[model samples]
Target: MAEMSYRTALVTGATSGLGRGLALWLARRGLRVFAAGRRVSQLQALAAEAQAAGATVEPVELDVTATDATLERIRALDGECGGLDLVVANAGVGGVTHAKRLQWERVKAIIDTNVTGAAATLSAVLPQMVERRRGHVVGVSSLAAFRGLAGHGAYSASKAFLATFMESLRVDLSGTGVRVTCIYPGFVKSELTEKNNFPMPFLMETEAAVDRMGNGILRGEGELYFPWQLALPSRLLKVVPNPLFDAAARRFR
Candidate 1:
């Protein structure tokens, strides 16, 4: 186990995928981890697995979409833990929302979970962190935030919103000892990505992707984009002419 600056951490969306992987990784590194998710079964499994590995991981049943409840639960958890050294707002939902056949329900879920839920998770911890002048907050965004993909309009937009939100927070909190990191990841194997029927380039396994993100969070990077293969092109797409970018994005449709 590597020496860590953080002694206690909370990871939202910890029932599966990157969130689960990150929670376990942090525990293994000697941090007391609070894994929050909606699935009781999965949370129990996570706690058991961590215990077997001789790590501390507590499961907290939370639905980030329930703003009031989420805020209350996390604040109480933070107080119980004495203070959260790190908080990862990794709870997010993804789906293909074609512009022509857009479903309001799907788009709303993406917004509620990815935007509202993530914001609530951070808000719940930030006040104390600010008062104490010590903490790290991470936001899991996506490379798709660089451009609005043809078939993933809403999902891409939500990520973009998160990235911008994190960036703003970083600037606002500078010199305050609160570190803000926004991670833009490419495709990683997860429940959310498994539903994609179209091709996913530069697909990454959950463990490897989470490892990279974990390192970045600990290093206190302001913005981390992984799998250079995809990150390079995605960064370029941000400046590509709209006419050219649209032509290429159409292939996903």
Candidate 2:
């Protein structure tokens, strides 16, 4: 894969965790970055840092889950940037709840942020990218998407949707010169993961995950799996018999 510069990358959920890390990493790459998130104060801090680093930073307030507002901000940015070279649909949500007791409202919230929000963000940007015949798009998935987990039923399903969505999108843009990458990162310590009650094996540092994402985006890798331990096993799950895999997975739990 050829390396692409981070000169025109738009990253979502930049207030914290992987989004923040990715925005900063891209800025360090001398990319004209549109750092998007919900927190006004945090975006301000990020702006200061990006400016100090000599990056043209546009900190836009965005709640990807919100329908009208999300699109409005995106439109505003599109006009401001003139054109976009990259869009990382990286906003996501994680929840600890039983599937049976999953509150309809809460589940919708999770779905809206992880699945609908992602789809909306990409859909909004895609026409522009296609019209220009350029741009790279990525969605941040999770190792949890590999298989169902006990408490993360909704979150896992949403991630799985992202993985599948990217596959479908790659086909849709096959000849458009637009690259689509689906990123699955495992056990990165973040506010989202801090609520987990169980142990995370081969857990990687957030910075490492961020770095991995930057490299993958720059190289235009189709599918990225980090922390080889998780990736290797996740691949095996596809071939392992349901009964045997369930038994082993339960033991690990």
Highest-TM-score candidate? 1
Residue 129's lDDT within candidate 2 is: 82
Best by lDDT: 1
TM-score (C-alpha, index-matched) for candidate 2: 0.94
Please give the CA lDDT of all the candidate structures: 0.92, 0.85
Question: On residues 1-253, what C-alpha lDDT tens digit does candidate 2 reach at each position?
Answer: 3555545878898988999999988888788888888897898899898888887677888889886778777766776878778899998878775766777777788899999999888877788888877889999998888888766778889999999999999999988878999999998988888878888888889999999999888888999998998899887787888898779767865
lDDT at residue 51 of model 2 (Cα atoms): 88
Cα RMSDs of all predictions?
2.1, 1.6
Expressed as tens digits, the lDDT of each residue in 47-144 for candidate 1 is 99999999999999999999999999989988998899999999999887988888999999999999999999999989999999899989999999
Return the TM-score for each candidate structure: 0.97, 0.94
Clashes of each: 0, 0
RMSD of 1: 2.1
